[model samples]
Target: MSEVDEYLRFFPYDEPYDNQGEAMDRIHTSLERGQDVLFEGACGTGKTLSALVPALEYARDAGKAVVITTDVHQQMRQFVQEARAITRQEPIRSVVFKGKASMCHIDVGYEECQVLRDNTRELVDARQEEAQLRERERQLLSDAQDGEERAVEARDAVVDELENVAERVQSISSEKNVCEYYKNNLTGNVDEFYEWLFDDVRTPDDVYDFAEARTMCGYELLKEGMEGVDLVVANYHHLLDPMIREQFFRWLGRDPDDVITVFDEAHNVEAAARDHATRTLTEQTLNQALDELEETDDPRTKRAANVLRPYRDALVEVYEDSFGFGERERVGDNWEDVAVANESGRDDLTIEFLQRYEGPGYKSDLEAAVMLGKDLDDQYEEAYKNGETTTRKDCQTLQSAAFVGAWMREGTDEGLHPVVSVRRDQGTDEVYGRAELYTCIPQEVTRELFEEVHATVLMSATLRPFDVTEDVLGLTNPVTMAYGLQFPPENRRTYAVSTPALFSSARDDPQVQEEVGTALHDAVRFTPGNTLVFTPNYAEAERYAQRLRQQGDATVYLDEAGVDANDLRERFTNDDDGVLLTSLWGTLAEGVSFDGDDATTVVVIGVPYPHLDDRAEAVQQAYGKAFDRPGKSDPGWTYAVEIPTVRKTRQALGRVIRSPEDIGVRVLLDERYTQQSRSDMGKYSVRGTFPPEERDEMIDLAPEKLKFAMMNFYQDNGRYDGPPPAP
Candidate 1:
């Protein structure tokens, strides 16, 4: 039997699916060889269980810990529950570790609470020493022969006192209401607590209840318990953060080389890592700092505010000029503004002065201001720890200053890019300026992590085109496995509209938007039960929703900006028949699953593509320089645009057909899906010529033809007996 077969005996299923067994075998082989693994398991393949069972089994047998990270909290919970079911026979321990902000009690700020933890540790040590002293006294009295009767009485009293000590340790939270969660779980023998917590706790909620009932800190308990856990489940940021990663390994009592890391829905890692590394300062945030300064009596904060005022105004002025205060188009050169903000002769400026500050170099006004900001941050943080309350405003100012200092210090690095922009609300005419320092390439942040971990398994349902992902994610010779859709081919019918007008980015034009809208309406008019209409962006989704509402034919639900995606999904699913209009980049596009009749039709209005603005072009250029081959057509556009679009489209398509028995219709309202082109050898004469490759999928049919085909398919294969409800 193969490795997967050995592990399959532990799973709840009598037998694994063909793809599941194959994926498990590949994952096991890669992990055992200490190699990075890239896996693409399509929906309905039980990707979570397939990855978790073998990974946990390997960790258990190898005597190593497994750190599982995913995009959302819900996914972490789901994975842990599945893991619990599979590991029931084994002694494997698992816990879902959430961020302090999520799991912490509301009484204390996360930072302040962290500071309090130090004090708690000191208290626990003192109490343990007292208990030890009592034991020593009791033992000495028991050994004395002169006072045998007194010794007997003394020993009984000591035994009673010891029992009281145990009771005090267990119920310390009752007397001390502050952070009872931490005291009860963290005060005792740590290893015993780790084992007991895992044995009793199955989910995050369970952990919360255990902590709350004892009035303890759930966050501290999990952190302490996580050191020896077989499987530690958490959101991506927990692993991505260098500080948290350091603490995690420390708690694990192991080196980074001993742990295996698994990232589920790994396609989202790039964005998550980028967000972690990126820093921004906006007008509203800075203004809050200014307000906070007014309430402070500290002369240093006042002085720092004075230094920041001019820099803030100058940046805002440039932003206002570029933003045009709700004008139809930008009015100023953004590149020039960036140069001016950085106080450099070149558009791409470096913080060379800040780099060699103590050394001989000419310091500009901006450099001096940044230095002052750093000093203020350090000074204020020290004050906050010295019994002075760190007002939320105080923290905000410190954060803004620290970000400014870091950006000014490292903005010149090749991995980092600086951007300045403004947004104006048309209704309020209120403009907010923002200055950001971000990484266009996530490799700069992720490359070190990949090299540090012993082994990593990155898996997702929509990680298509292994080469693009490999290059973008900085994976080196990874063992890759792509499992085809496990659901039967006939379970989902995909169609592309053969309209005269193509649905491309040019749909911004009123006429094109009208045409696409009509084509979309025609596609879903005959579909039965629930139908989901996905647009390329929020604005387009709203536009289509408005038009649909104007028709006054069907009950339409729009996933607007402020509305919760989950709540909206629930509302639509609960209705007997309705339409849910949402964005292609939304939560519903990927993780949300639909059963037999609900969400039976998915109308993808357009090929989701990023707008070709300055930032977009810069990203393409950066990728072109980094990944494009010397003697072939640049794959920059493909990496930056085409691949992401396809991945998102595939995710939206996957949402409908979640089960083998569940059937759905997929409608593509774009003609671009049918188009193909040959790379002109003449155009590439400067470099070596190459053969043309196939383009995107082509499931084309005229509007009339598409309507008829969908109707026939629904009538023939749909679970519902009647024809589609009339629009």
Candidate 2:
């Protein structure tokens, strides 16, 4: 569309989806004006072309940067595959961006890698040899019925050599060629070999040199011939999180506002931003760090110890105040600042030291400090000198306090974004710390990131109680838009207030359980399709789901019932007539989608309300009077937290009926649908039985309610009639 020509070109599509051409036309205009575009398409509305295809076109024609950001990585993969199919031989420059940890870094030379491998291999061989020698000596003695002192001594000598070799191998330092960024930064030397080892690695084998997730960006940034890169696809973290934005996409240049950013499933913005802003670290982690420091003499090992001592001392001083032994109702609101206020805990001081502590050979000190993980610290010098990949990314890495996730995006007068991460230190086995941060009231991040971006397009199917999201995000003034992306009348049925008092303080009337069971049973009874029941809390989700399951209702429990994300994906993908009962609008309720015949009916039980958290009281007091008036606000509900959650429900309910031909049902159990929270539900709802109208034609009201509704809904609309389907 611009002056740039012949850089790259892909054949125009002969056939495209209903909206692909129109979508690309909008994009062409957007590129012409240098404006950002947010397109919200219903599930089957061909969203990829709106930005994906257009971005590629823009990358070829305008020579402008194009980024496709999606919270869901799987969608990103599908997008990449589609792009590859379209531009099989086109010169359209494209690369997937991922975090630094995702790629493998040849941080060490081949010889070093080989030396470490060979030495370790030798140690293993020597040990095997010694073991065989001892076995042989024993056999010899047994065969002769006589003890051979010389043979036994020889076995012992071999064993000793094996041990010595192991120790020697363990003495040198080596690093795991785990991620390409690390390889690019450390081995690429960033100086002499930038063009050699530092360029991006395009194929899958090299992408593994990145991260477990194989996030989009890492694939592109570390490509073997990364220059002249055209389109860079990434997630919000890569574009919004400064540390990530600077490190991964900086290669593309910093002016993102000027760059075309297409947010796929953009509606995840609020929750995604909130999650990115949350900070967490723990005492167990700090202690382990201290332990790691004592294991090696590598400069990084020593530097970490030096950096931690002052903080340790300061922690001891404030320990009595910030923490107490048992479940002592979480610390105060501003405890984070208070913990670091004592000169020793000053973040700036600790950060300065962490950033500069050079390694033994004057390499990046941060790289060296990473080696001090509790499990592998003792093996640091050995791994470094040898060249082996270590340092954790999964559970072990979770314990790290690297950068400690502090935020100073806003200052004291506006409000301190103070947060104190705490959890039942259920030991290392089940440690879960929850962090709360008001990024809008930044306490640690650079405010320039938010203020300088030219335009940010936040679009998700559901960002509910928009005002509440605005209040928490402090972005009430942004241009807001919504699309009525409803499922087809023949595709889905929705029931409002299907059951009475399913979960609430007043829900314990014994009969309520039987009633819930009966309703849930009917929801799943005849239909072999998957059924998802959303509850209000973990306990309630557990209670109702357990009740239904005890009667062999064939249900999978979602969150609040001790169910997690894995469990959700399982139930969504499992065979036994997949049925899931979970907290309404929980994480799973909001973020996951089940396509095809995987889902049929989603039952929402009660409104999602945040329980009384440590800071809930203060938050309620601050804006509760102004917005939550009369009996409108419940202390049990952090409207700040819950409203966003209900929006999650809206999204979950949207998952099943992805296309017009797909049939599904949404059942809301909360009687509150007749009252106040009803407003929150409607604002973000894609399809449902809107109250006052109460029950839709597809909504079944009683005993025969479910069976009759299912029959009719399928009578005319079920096209997958190609065969029997999940009920």
Candidate 3:
């Protein structure tokens, strides 16, 4: 009908969906118009094609090279796989840009770096805090007419906590058990918070806790970092947080804004943004700094003291107002915290806030506040600014506090939570309150972030109310596009079966567990072949999977030790004959596929929804006030729950009956679906075939029975899609 439509007809893809067509048109128009595009398609819509097809075609038309990169080797390979479909149309050449550290020797130089210099200042701050702790201890010792008992008791608590956490560190992995060279092997449980702080180390148990380890270990990402790339897929951190961004751009010194960014599994953006905002302070720093004032004599140490003198006043003010100004600090037995209720400057913060606090556009207000404790060209400007003075004070209190305010720095024993300090690892808990983490919000909007890029496209199957992702992710003002695949129910039999089991929220209830087991058994039997049971939550999934395994044969329930989803997929793909018991958090629930004879029955256990997430909790609270306010539904939950559920459902359903001959049953077990007049699944919901009254019978349809029915339906409906992409 049109030149673009005509061009599409010759394209190798057999059939496309409503969203896919819309997205392609928008993408084509954007490139033709010479406007940058930020296409936010949901997962599964084949958005990769929307960007890729245009990239390849453009490369040929313009006689230029095309480079494409995703987050990892697999992702890059996925793009290469897509390129083959159109390889006949245009030749493709690509390369993987990996960080030097990926190969073994780390390329990051630690000597004479401005960043490392800042790190040195951290040690100086820590030394100052240590001095204060000594001062507090001396004060407490002087007041303890109660003798060593009180001091010993307080001191022991802190030390004991450290010992307890050290005991809790996990032993070496099972893979290392057979090695004669097995190194440190510590077992048994201990206090984790203590080790994370006093000792300040990130162990394997620290995977999710300290974010610093994730950053260093993720040094693997740099191996793939660099430019002249067509598409770059990365975590939200790469583009948003400043500390991560600075190093991120180091590997690829070229304009990072040149390539398009596509966030896979993008619902996590809000958390990424909030993480950009939290700040913390350590109790150790307060204690140690008091000690340092009494203990240190060097000009360097005194200089460090002068810088902290003001913040110390702020702390004393908060403390005295809360605790009624009492001068007593010492190891009461360790782990003793004494905050005063009324001190010299306790009321100063309110004064400071009133002097600041701008409404609505508060970013400028935040900027002005940061300028207060920073190095100004004019020294008098520093005095008038708040606490600005010489470069030394400018370096510690003023500059540090401003840095903390803008970047939201949270201090700890090691300074920064869920992030480890590389500087403090120099043996002994030497530097207290030394921050290992540095996170910052990106000033650039997604559009502004990539304004320098020439052309781009983004697509996914779950792109609904598409504006949600676009607006939040800073992609709002871009040429919008949508491309979809044929999503109608296939010759495959689909059922929405209700389970009798009530979610126990209480795990110890055996009867509830049994009911889940029974439901899983009945659901799994409908197919003449292997089945996959999908649980919305990890605990519930594992519980049911364990229950099923008790009466099982050829069932594979993965170990509690979390395995990467891809590895699990390979196992599922290779061993399609076995029943796969997978949870929402694990691999089987999303991304990977289980189809044809390998999986003939798919059992969805519950309505996947947000249960517990602080960010989500905060979003619901804030968004409620931001939108409807006081009394209303959450805009956050609608996106977090409804949207994610729709995406999950689409992913689970996609797993079964790959081809017409390859038939299977997809059973959604939640009653929540039945309660609604229509689910967000829209036409993809099971109602198009089975009447609500006969919904249970849909489960009985099974693979053998459904294939015959599907053959008849196809006689009338025909195949919505012609064939699968060639392997």
Candidate 4:
């Protein structure tokens, strides 16, 4: 057998699917050549094991560790399970690393936990010093009694300080302020835990249980076990955030070039990178900072608050200038209300405007405020250490100052767009202002890490149009592969119906709504089991739900925003004939399993275009400027709008056919999907966005013919027991 065949022994399955074998071979070849891989494999292709096996084989031979990061926490469990299966064939150690906030036993934020851990360490050290001083004092006194002149002077030096040292130790050893779990970890023997961690593939929950039994910190134990592990499963922040990434590499004791990294659900990497780089300072936080400073007795802190008040007032004036304040208006008889004229608006923050406050005198005051904020933070820490404060509250003043400092340092980058906006809280309906430095390009955050890593693999089921992914993420020349659905085509039926297009312009037309409602009623009535209808957004979902209830006999369930989505899913899953109406971008679209008889039909109502907000407009403008070509069509619409919309629509369509054994019908209820050429109505048709296999199989039909197609499909598959329903 060849070397590749030898490495295939590590595959846990009895046999590999054709696509899985191809994916593994290509990935293995790429890793050997030290090249990055961008792979798109459809569901049921066994993506996890296919990527894991070759990565493991390469890491072992190359003396590198495999680091797998995912966007969802639940994916970590899949990694652990796959690792366990691999361990059955060979002895390999893997550790599941979680965020500090999740691994912590105490109910506190990660920052607060760090403060507690620091105090615990200081208390332990102070007590040890006190004991040593007492012991030395006794020895010195004994020597003085023996008539040693040098000892007499030493005794005098140490005698008067014993009481002060005891008091200091007492002040630090506050049980209310210190973390006992961390204190136990300082001396806890992890020999047994370490052995157990390496003996099997342990998940984060398993580590938590074992650590709780031994009264040690699970996070610390996981860090300790990272030294010898062959695989490390962690979240995206561990690799995307700079500070966390630094600490993560430090724990591994390996440089980036010594490790192979795999980003699961890599489609989210762009949004995740942008999120990590974005920062905001809110009006509420600023007001809270002022309140905190006002409550403090320190004169310097009070002065700092005075310096900040002007900046806060200046920002408020900017908000008013951009979007006017709420106005009092007469309502019903003897009633009045305050209505905000402009609920949301964004305005550019120019350097000229910023320099007005950043000039010499104001700059000095700002620097003083920063120092005073630190002083106040230290004072709060001392209070916590002395047991005077039972809980730690972040020094909001320090947070505000630090944000200003960061804005000054990094806000000038071309990729960073600093703007102020007036936003209303959804829950409270209170209008407030905030300043944000938005990161437009994902490459600004991801390029360096990809370059530094030995090899990288980015794979997702919906990742397509490789150039867009490459350009947006700034990936260099790398291996790119796209795989079709592995399931048999005979079991799945997809149709693009010629219904009234549910474009933004046509949604409010009553005639169009009736025609679309009639089509959906017929489609849902023909399906044998539960059906899912995905709209573009919640409002549209609710609108269709009402129409379906009025026109059809099937039970309709509408997804509401802010409700318990899991409970809703459970109820929908239990009802065999219920039709669930949810948005394409909602919780049920992605990372959800609707296998077996759960969702036998999925109807995507329209394209899931992102709302045309300030941010979306800015992204479009930025991409156009960055990627426009000389003679080709502009890439702004395709990159920023059309591709992402199709990806989301496909994600919703994928909810029905989860496995090879599953059978389902997919319907696309928009004319744009089947349009052969771009017209004045729609510039781009999304039918080309689909994979070749799916695009070739899609049958276009009129709204009246959809019921017949669905009926014939179910009957052909032997799933329908009766004749077609009356039209």
Candidate 5:
């Protein structure tokens, strides 16, 4: 058998799908050549197995470990399941690393956890020292004879020292500030736990349950057991965040060169990278810092707070000027302004303004703030140890100081934008100032990571337009593979209807919304199972939901901000024919499966473009400056806006059909998608943005005919039982 066939033995199935086999072969080839692979396979292409099988085979032979990073807990659990299947065939060890907060048995925050661990370590060290002294004293007493004066003196002195040490140990043991879980982990033998962890592939939940029963720290066990593991699964932050990545690699005891990394759902890498790099300092944070300082008796901390006070005022002034809150009328009951505040409250603050503002000494004050914050942090720890406080909250003063320091250091970096915004308290209409340093370019974080790793495989169902991905992510000449949808073409139908484009200018027009809503109502009524509607934003989602509730017979569920999505998903999935109305870039749009009879239709109301706020405009301008050329037509908009929007639309489309056995209908309720010609499509055309396979399957029809076509489709698929609905 060939090398690819050999790898297939660990595929955990009798036979691989055609796309799966092709993907495996290509990924294996890329790995062998020491090149990264960008694999784009549709929903039914067995992405997890295809990526894992080759990665495992290559890593096992190359004396490397496979590090798999996902975007959600479900994906991580899926990885664990796949790893277990591979383990049954070969005895490879795999472990899942969850965040410390999740794996911790105690109900404390991150800073508290650190404090407890520190105190526990001190106690354990003191006890060990006491034990050693007692052993020495016992030996001395045994050796000293009744007549030997020098030996007797030595024995007596050692006994006295042991008693003092014992007292210290007792004092430490009696302290209530230590983490018993961490203490147990430090003192108890974990060889059996390690053996059990390595015996089979384990999920984070499994590790948590086992460790909880044994009264041990699961995070510590996973950290210590990483030496010989063949595969590791973790969330994106474990690999994206710089400090966390450093600690993660330390646990693995391997350099980037010794590991093969796979970024599942790799389209999210850009956003994840940006999120990790973004920093914000709020007015409340500064006030809390002042509060902390006021409570402290130390003169140094008080002086630091004094320095911070003026800086806070300066920051607020910047926000006020940037947002023009003083100039605008405070229309309390204006629905539009409220929506604007709820949707895009941020306004641009030029880097030059931040650099040139002379109201306060930004650089000097911020630097001093950092130093003072560190001093205050040390003082707080000292106080905690002395039992001056019942509990220790995180030092917001230090946090604020660090944020300002970071802004000062990296604010002017290309692709990083400074913005000021206001937050209105819900209980009271009081507005507070907030500042953020947004990282617009994923390349800032991902370029170094991908370059340093041995090889990376970025697989997603919608990671198309390789040029955009490569340029934005700063990938070198990597192998690219795009596979068509593996499911039967007959099982799926996509229609780009003839409704007027719901562009920002036309979305509020009652005529356009009614037509779009009418098309969705029909689609929901005709689809046998559940239907999912994806809008451009929450405002649009709510508008369409109202229309559907008024006109359609199906139960309409709307996704609201700050609501628990899991509960909503459970309710929707349990319904027989419920319509879930949500926006793109939400929980339901990606990393969620609506397989089987859960959802039979997904309706995209409009092209889900990035909100055109100050940040987005700044990013577009930055991309234009970075990648624009004389002959290229709007490369910046294409890269920064259009491509990502198309990816979100496709992510929503992929939600309904998860396997070959699943049948689904996709509706694009806008004329812009169908009006574009493949030959002369503009940079902003939604249809032009789609991958070729998706474009090929799309059929354009008038809005009134959408329900008829859907009805015909369901009937042809043997799912429709009732008569054809009126269009």
Candidate 6:
């Protein structure tokens, strides 16, 4: 056997599947060569275990550290469990690190809780020394003949309390202002604490329970122990934030060169980074800042607050005048003209007025206000730590000023857009407003994050059309890997619901809506077991659901706007037979699994294209620049609209069959999927080609064909090669 085969023999799972073995080899090789790898593996390919085994193997052999971060903590915990199982079979060690906020033992802010933790060790040592002296005295007193019984009782009481330190220490610590468990155990036994903590920590709740039992801060213990761990599992935000990254490095006493980072569900990482980079200033934020400033004694902070209040007013005026109340209007692209109109001044006057506050003197005011804001925040937290009831003022005016001032002066990157909108109450017309600076194309951010690690791996199921993802995510010509179905391909099928109907916004009349609704009602009625209907928007979903109800469909569950989504999902999954109507990109589209009879069919309506508003237009223009689209084609629209639509549709389809034994069918309810030409409209306007010659997974929308194909596919369980099966 070869060296690679030898390594495979040690894989701690129930033997890697065919596709899994290939993925493992590719991941190991890429990490060895220090090349970033973008891997697309389907759901049942064991992507997590595949990535973990090879990455851990590489780390073990190379004496390097590995950090596995995902978009969700549940996934992180799942990974940690898998890593632990692997370690049981190997000689590697792993650690799971949730952020400070998550692992905090107290109901206090991170900064304040950290302060309490910092001094805990010293306090515990001093308390322990005192307790030892008391113990000696108690023993001596117990030896005396006079009052011997009372002395024994006193000594026993002291011993009992000391023994119960881990259990009742939290209350003791609160009463005496000392962490009793820290004094008794964690002060000198960091490794022992981890052993106890991880002994039964299968989830976040388990971590909290274990720590609470010992009255120890899980964050501190886990953080201190991360240095000796071979693999660390955490959420993506922990590594994406620069401060958190630096803090982790300091804890490890190592640099970026010694680590390999694997971003699971990496398709979502760029979007997370983009969100991290975005900032918003809400009217509530401004009001809170003003309230805090008015209560403060500092004249400079008060002066800054005075200017900030008007700035807030100016922003509100802009939103109200430009977009009107209760309407979502896009902000204009011309910053100077918008600013002039909102401030009710000429361009030069507006620039001068805003710049005056951003100048040297106002800079001092801004800094002072920010410093005071921190002081007040810390004060409130300290009071909370001391068991005093304190109300925190939501004031940070200078911070808002700083963000707005910077954006106004420096403008935004080519890809990012600044937006403003106003929301008003129906009865009172009380205005709540927001201003946001955001970016849809996250390639620049993704590129920068990749540069921080020695080697990186981006993995997802729907990262197909690998070249597009590579270009869109700004990878450095990395090796692209794809893994096909590990399950019976015959168990799954896709069909186009071809009807001469218009579902686009251009034909959003009640007649078209009713026709679309009727088609969906019919599809749900025909399909047995559990069925999921994906519409372009909530309004449409509600319409279709109403139509279903009118047609005597009692088992219709509509995803209402602003409802608790988890409850909705639970209700849908718990029902053995029903139809669930949800919008595309809603909670049901992704990050959910409805295997077996839970979801036997998925029906998707028209493409869920985003509105071509100002922010989206800005992103499109940015994409044009990023791809350097000097040709006739619009790269922006393709990247922002077409790509996302396909990806979301694919995500919806993916939910149908989650396991090897699962069977399901996918129905596309739009004419575009059935047309010979790529048609955005009914007239058949092909972009470049119809369905792209390479993708052979599409089939006709005939009902009989769909039924026959799905039934036969499941019955035969035939293996799928490269071509589509005959209907």
Best by TM-score: 5
Query: On residues 1-727, what C-alpha lDDT tens digit does candidate 1 reach at each position?
Result: 7677677655756778888887888788777888998888777788876777677768777878888889866677678767777666555677777777767765666556754564455447657855885876667576755566767666776677767766655554233223345566666445644555767436667767766766777667777667667888878887887777888788887788888889998988878877787778877777777776676566555455654554466566655545445452543322222322232332222233233233223224335434555555565545444435433113556656666666666666655667776665556666566777767788766777888887888888777677777887888999988775677777667786744333454766887767777777766666767888888888888888888888766689998877988888888898766889988887788766777777888887766776666655656767887886865366767777767777787778767877888777888776555432113323212111111111222355766677677777777775555656443
Residue pairs in candidate 1 whose N, alpha carbon or C atoms collide under 3 angstroms: 180-215, 180-216, 181-215, 181-216, 181-217, 182-216, 182-217, 227-251, 496-699
lDDT of 4 by residue, 343-365 (tens): 13322343323533543454565
In Å, residue 576's CA in model 4 sits off its true spot by: 2.0
How does model 2 score by TM-score? Answer: 0.62
**For each candidate, what is the lDDT?**
0.68, 0.51, 0.44, 0.80, 0.81, 0.66
TM-scores of the candidates are: 0.81, 0.62, 0.55, 0.88, 0.89, 0.80
Which of candidates 2 and 3 reaches a greater TM-score? Answer: 2
What tens-digit string does per-residue lDDT give for candidate 5 at 361-477?
566666666777787778777656544654765678889878867765766677777766666655667666676787888788999888888999998988899978988888999
The candidate 3 region of ten consecutive residues with least summed lDDT is 175-184
Inter-residue clash pairs, candidate 5: none
Query: Which residue runs does candidate 4 get wrong by more than 4 Å?
Result: 123-171, 174-176, 292-307, 318-361, 382-389, 405-413, 419-430, 675-682
Better by TM-score, candidate 4 or 3: 4
User: Tens-digit lDDT track for model 3 on 1-727?
Assistant: 6635644632557766566666666666666655555455433466677665555455445443333433334454465456545544433333333332332222333221223233333333444445555565555556555576677666555455544433322211111111111110111122342233223212222322332332232222222223333323344555545565556555444444333344444344434554654444443453454354445343334443443444444444433343334322311232222322112332233232334433543334334433432433134333322223222221223344453343332222111222211112234533222221322222123444455445444444444455555544455366654432233344455554444324436345675455556556655543455778777667776777666677665556453455776666666657644667666555565555565566767777766554644334434443433344344345555544455565566567656755546655666665434424146445323333222322433443322233344334433444324531121
How big is the positional error of residue 330 in model 3, measured in Å on the Cα after superposition?
27
Q: Please give, for residues 495-521, the per-residue lDDT of candidate 6 as tens digits.
A: 775544444644467756665565565
The TM-score ranking, best first, is 5, 4, 1, 6, 2, 3
Name the regions of candidate 3 deviating beyond 4 angstroms.
1-23, 34-46, 56-73, 83-95, 98-104, 107-403, 407-456, 477-488, 500-515, 562-572, 595-598, 627-633, 657-662, 675-727
**Which is the leading candidate under lDDT?**
5
Which ten-residue region of model 5 has the weakest summed lDDT? 334-343
- Model 6: pairs clashing at backbone N, Cα or C within 3 Å: 289-395
| Cα misplacement distance, residue 574 of candidate 2 (Å) | 4.7
lDDT of 6 at 121: 55
